[model samples]
Every structure is written in structure tokens, then in C-alpha cells.
Target: MAQFTFEGDFEILADPQIKLVESALQKKGFTNGKIVVEPVGQKGDNYIAHVKRFIYEAEDGTTFNMIGKVAPVAEQLRLMMNTMVLFNNEIVMYNLVLPKLNDIQNSAGVTDDEKVRFPACYGVVTEEPYEFILIEDLKEAGFEMLDKMKPLTNESVRLIVKDLAKYHSLSYVLKNSEPEIYESYSNKLSNLWAIVGAEPEAQQFFESGENDLFKMMHDVSDQYKNVVRGSLTQITPIAKKIQSYEKGSKYSVIQQGDCWNNNILFRLEEGKPVDDVMIDYQLSSEGNPAADLLYLIFNCTDHATRLEHYQEWIDYYNETLDHSLNLHGLKANHIFPKDQLDADLKRYGKQMVNLGVLLSSMLERESKDALDMRVMTGDKEKLWENTMAQMNASLLDISTIVKIRQRIMGIIDTALEFGLI
Candidate 1:
């Protein structure tokens, strides 16, 4: 509170959470400075946590910046979002998993340019309700999140999967090199959907959304609707199967888990891809590596792009994964063979496409219609306990519906063509 200027209502951070930030800043050598706190990104861009940018104007005129994923102050929303599990998963990734991964690459003398790039964690506070992850701001390095509604270009997709392969290689390294340590992380990450499936309230929330999705499919033929249902309605059970400890653990790697456009940030140089980093690990879980590719390919790119490069992207990811493993003296065939990867894709492909359909709705929502967020906020919940009246309003937009429809059907088409479904 001394020299900190809260740009908005985030001044609510006057609690012990503020002290955590102050301590991290002070440790970084900013003994005397003004810290400006403000929110980052739009409503639809992020939902689980409030992403805030903290800028410290040091006495010497150089400003230091950090990004904080802060829990909402509203307890009702906190319970609904289950920040307890989500934030704890992230804190462990930053505090435990990623550091171990960095050590493996460093010991191998991997160059910084070739290693998996993640933001440096300054501090992590997993104290319930007040949980937040404080890390270096990627924006300082010119990294930015792509537009959620648009398709990622082939070049951009290459940069994404290339980094994904490298990051996943570390997972295999940690698993083979230090099995005990890797198992600990695998045990720690809770399956978000498995938890949702257990809670009646959470189940209702998704069931409502699922109902709307089925309504959208009313326009399609029964053959295609069955294809849609193969994954869509079975979401919870399929996710449980994938995230469960027994599911393909031999071939599993620490997947980005929720691999979508919004969770990845790219640094563009003159309108083309240069470097990119994956952010938001709340859903990070141990699963078949194929889950990441299927999720990203279906959810991030358009049908046209996937048709031209779907098989190529999978091969590219395999090549890159093998190369990353080779850098540290591990062999992909010895650990995750190409045949196994293809089998995993066939096994998990439809379930992952189901994820694309669900994410497509939320991520593709027009800015003006993203107000379903109101249902999550306590204040809005208080006013509208019976909000079914406005439930499908956003999903009703013609253009938004088209995007969602195309993604759903196109996802199925590609899977069918590849013999995955």
C-alpha cells in the first residue's frame, strides 16, 4: 500500500496476497518503487483466473513487470470455479514440475533457444481463496495471445507443436530419468472434468451447455449427429478415461492438457511466427501425447487448414518430439514409438475432438455476447438465479453459430478421414 497504485478494483489485494507480491518485488531488488496493478486481456480471453500485470517503476527509471493469475475475491465464484484444485495444479507446475524439467535440459547442456521456454516463476501462493501465481511477464519479450476466434496459420501451428514436442520431451526425460519425481506430479494434477462429473452443480452446468450443443446439431443428419455424440455427450467419461492414471501411462507425457489457441502466446516478428510459449497449466495432466495434438489441431485450426496439413502436422510433431528426446540421449522408439503415437491418436482422437466442440463455443463467443460470465460472478448470480432465459442468447448469434458448427462438423470429418473415429 505504501507506493503501490492499484489501477482498478484489484486494490482488494490489500490482504496478505499484496504482501506476497511486495515481498517478491522487494527480493528482486526493487526496494523503493511504485507498482502499478491492472488487469490484462478481455473477458472471453481468460476465465478461470484474473490475469493481472504488475509494473514496478524502479527508482533508476527501468520498469520491471510480472504477470499474476489471481483468484477472484468473490467466494461464490471461487467455489464455482474450484480455484482450490485449479490454482494448486498450476502452483505445483511452476514450483515443482517446470523447474525439474529445466534442470534436465540444462544438465544436458541444451541451448536456451532449443529448450522449452516458460516464464520464470517469481513466487507461488497456493493458500486457498488467495491463491495466485506470480511470474515474469511474457509481454516484456513481445509475446501475445492470438485471437481466440481465428484459425492459426500453418506456420504458426508449426511453431506451436514444435515447442510442444520439446516441452513434452522433458516430461519423458523426467519420467525415465527420475520416475519417482515424475510420478509425484502425475498423482498431483486433478482431472478437472472428473471433479466436475462428481459435483451435481457442475454436472448441471455442463449438461445445460450440452443441451444447447445438441440443439445446434438439430440441423445435421442423424448419421452426423451420431458422430457428434460419439464424443460430445460422453465428454466427462472420456476425460476420466484419458486423465485416469491407468490410461496409457507407458506412453504418457505431461501434456499441456488444455491445448487451445487462448492458452498459447506467440511472439510475432513482422507478421510471422518467431517464438511462442504455452501459458495456463491449470489443466495440466499426464496423458497420451496424442491428446495435445488432437486438441490443438481440431480446436485451433480451421477444417481447411487441417485437411491440407493434418497428417503432416502429426508427423511434424512426431519428428520434433523425437528430435527433442534425442538431444538428451533418449530414443523416441525406446520410449514413445511412432506406431504407438498413431494408435494413441486413434484411441483418443474423438474424445479430444469433443473437447474442441466444447471449447469452440466459449472461445468463439463474440465479445458482446460473452456475458455468460455474469452467471459466474456472485453479484450477477444473486440477481439472476433463474438465468435460463438468457442461457442460449450468446450461442444464438448467426455468425458465432456458424463458426461453432463448422468446427464441430469439420472436426468429425477429419477424424473420419483419418480413420480415428
Candidate 2:
């Protein structure tokens, strides 16, 4: 028998992780072959996990492909990103929550076309320090993520919110039908922001970003800038309230906590979106639908596009939610009414503005300035010493500063206009 070979970026993985992947392959009857695993997407596309695509070839000319997401190796990076908590939450999402949700949809006789799309977990390894999740590669199935730098078109926006309605509605379904099971998983998922809020580094990191944020506001009018300055005080408190277990409200559903362009993949037909698959549930948790709505809108689309269709998108999401609820003989008006939904939006909008600035900073980084894989992979003492130091306004180039300001300020303008701020 020929020995198995691991190639490319797969070499970075430790022995235990590589063995786990080999074991997973053996379980699929793929033994003794060339297994090539390489990093996925470009640098800075994702900051939290080290994602890679694994390819296997057999002598009979068969091919198997999948994606593996491993916890970042560096202890400093782990602390900075709340890596362990986020990884475990996603493991729960795939291994427990999503499967049950899909079964509920199937038992209701909902067609595959209408069900929430998620990649299948081929296997998972959580032994000690070597933790990784292997999932079906959406790229092999013809799904592609939109570019982070580009604004989503109106068509893309509609499909996203439309599908988002299906995804969020199921949480309500699971809650009503199987409250025990719902609570079991929801309770286990940790709130990343809430966890970080208690840390000493959190304040300094946020303040560093806030300083850069104001510097970017140089070209903005005094009226809007002051409105933003006033809202700053509410940010820390709002971050705590979001995904808050103590204050969990009736309107909260399991939201796709990171609902931006890159976290969702689209299957396009001739440049038009036909369907989408939800990815990156690392930050997903029991949260308000309004938070998801605001995230999708403010982070994915710019101010001009939103100024044209902001109200329309909200209306459409509510309508789609109502339609999806009817699947299980339930009523959205009874469970999550339009009035309640609108109230939640107003409640969460300010914090959305704060997070929008953070997202834009990551999205607009040029390739040269993109996250250095080495730093993330390196382990060193004094982990928290440089928290958010790189984002210092004086350290950034004029071009990047302008881009971050414009993207974030655009979100602010839309929020203020919609009365969300």
C-alpha cells in the first residue's frame, strides 16, 4: 500500500490535525493517496480562522474536496479574537443546531429550494489543542463569495435578505416546536462580544479603533460628526446588550451574527444570484433579527445604495419572515410582529454604526496591508501589549484612512436618515 502524502499549506498543520484529516479520509474509504490542502481565499478575507481547502485523488480517477477550518495556532491571536469560544459555537451550530433545523424544515415538507442553505460537516476534531472542522467545499458545488471590497448590488441584497428570512424564521420554528432543544443549543453558544467586554484589552482595542474613526471623519459635516460623537457613549453598553443572555428578549432569534458579504456565498447564473449559502456561524448566537438586518445592510452595501432602498429592504425581510413562519402553521404577527421588529431595529441601530466602522477597516485593507499570516501564526509573550495598535490613525496611509471613513460614514448617514441612530 502507498503511504498518504500531505502537500502545500497543509504542512503548517501539526501532526495531530493532519492525522485527524487522514482519519476522516480513511472513514470515507480514501486511503493511501495524495491529499493536497491549501489555504482558502486571500489574506484578510477572514481574520479569525485559518481556512483551507483539501483535495484528494484516487487511482480510479475519483476526486474528493472539502474545507477545513482550524483554530489559529498563535496564543496571542487566540486571545485577541476570542478564538476558542467562537470555534466551539460554530461546532454547535453545525453539529447540533443546523441539523435539527434542517430536519424541522424537511418534516414540514418544505422543498430543498426553500430551506436554509448550509454546508455539511464531514467531520470534526476537538482533542486538546488540535481542533478543526471539515466541511463540504461550497466552491466545488458552484457557490462563490462576493468580493469584500465591492458593494453588493440590489439583486444580491434581495436574495440575501430573502434567504436570511428563512434562516432566522427557523429559530422561531425550533423555539415553538422544540423549546427544550432550542434552549439546549442556544444556551451553549457563547456571546463573543459579551466575553470580550469583560476583558481589560477590549477597552483599549475599541478606543484605538475609535480614534481612527474620528480621524476618518475629517471631511464630514459637523452636524453628522457630532451625532456620531454623541452616540459613542452608548456603544459599550450596546455591545454588552447584544447577544445578552440576561436580557434576552422575545424578539431574539439565532441570528447569523456576522452577516456581511464575505460570510455568505452566492451561486450566480450569468452574473445574477440564484441562491446563497450561509457560512461563518462563528459569531452566530441568540440575537435580534434587527441586528442581522442592520449588519447585512450597513456592512455589505454602501450609503448611496442604502439611501435608495433601505426601507424597501427592511419591508422585504419582514414580508419574507412572515411567509416563512407560515410554513409551520405559525404566525409571525403573533410571535414577532412588525411593530416589535421595527422597535428592535431602533434599539440596535446605534451599535450597528459602531461595528460598521470596524468592519470597513478590515474590508478596505489593500493586499500589502492585509493581515500578516505570520503574526497570527506566531506565538509570543506580552500578547495583549499591541492590541489595536496597528489601527493607530498616524500609522495608516492616507488612502486607507479615507476609505475606512467613507464606508463607515456612509453607514452613519443611512442610519441617521432612517432614524435608526
The alpha-carbon lDDT assigned to residue 85 of candidate 2 equals 89
Q: What is the Å distance of residue 10 in model 2 from its true position?
A: 1.6
Kindly report which residue stretches of model 1 are placed more than 4 angstroms away from their true locations once superposed: 1-9, 245-248, 371-395
Candidate 2 lDDT over 282-338, as tens digits, reads: 988888888888988999998889999988998998898999999888888998898
**CA RMSD for every model?**
2.5, 2.3
lDDT by residue for model 1 over 1-421, one digit each (tens)?
3455445446646366787788888787667777788878876677677788888887689899888888766777666666788888899899999888989988999998898898899998777778888998998999988888789999999988898899889999998988989999888887776665565555555567677777788889875677655454477877776676544468887777777888888999998878889888998877878888888888888888988998888899889999999998998989889998898889987787777777767766777666444235554344234333345634377877887777788878888888878
How well does candidate 2 score on lDDT at residue 286?
84
- lDDT computed for candidate 2: 0.79
lDDT scores of the candidates, listed in order: 0.78, 0.79
* Model 1: worst 10 consecutive residues (lDDT sum): 380-389
Cα misplacement distance, residue 106 of candidate 2 (Å): 1.3
Error of 2 at 213 (Å): 1.8
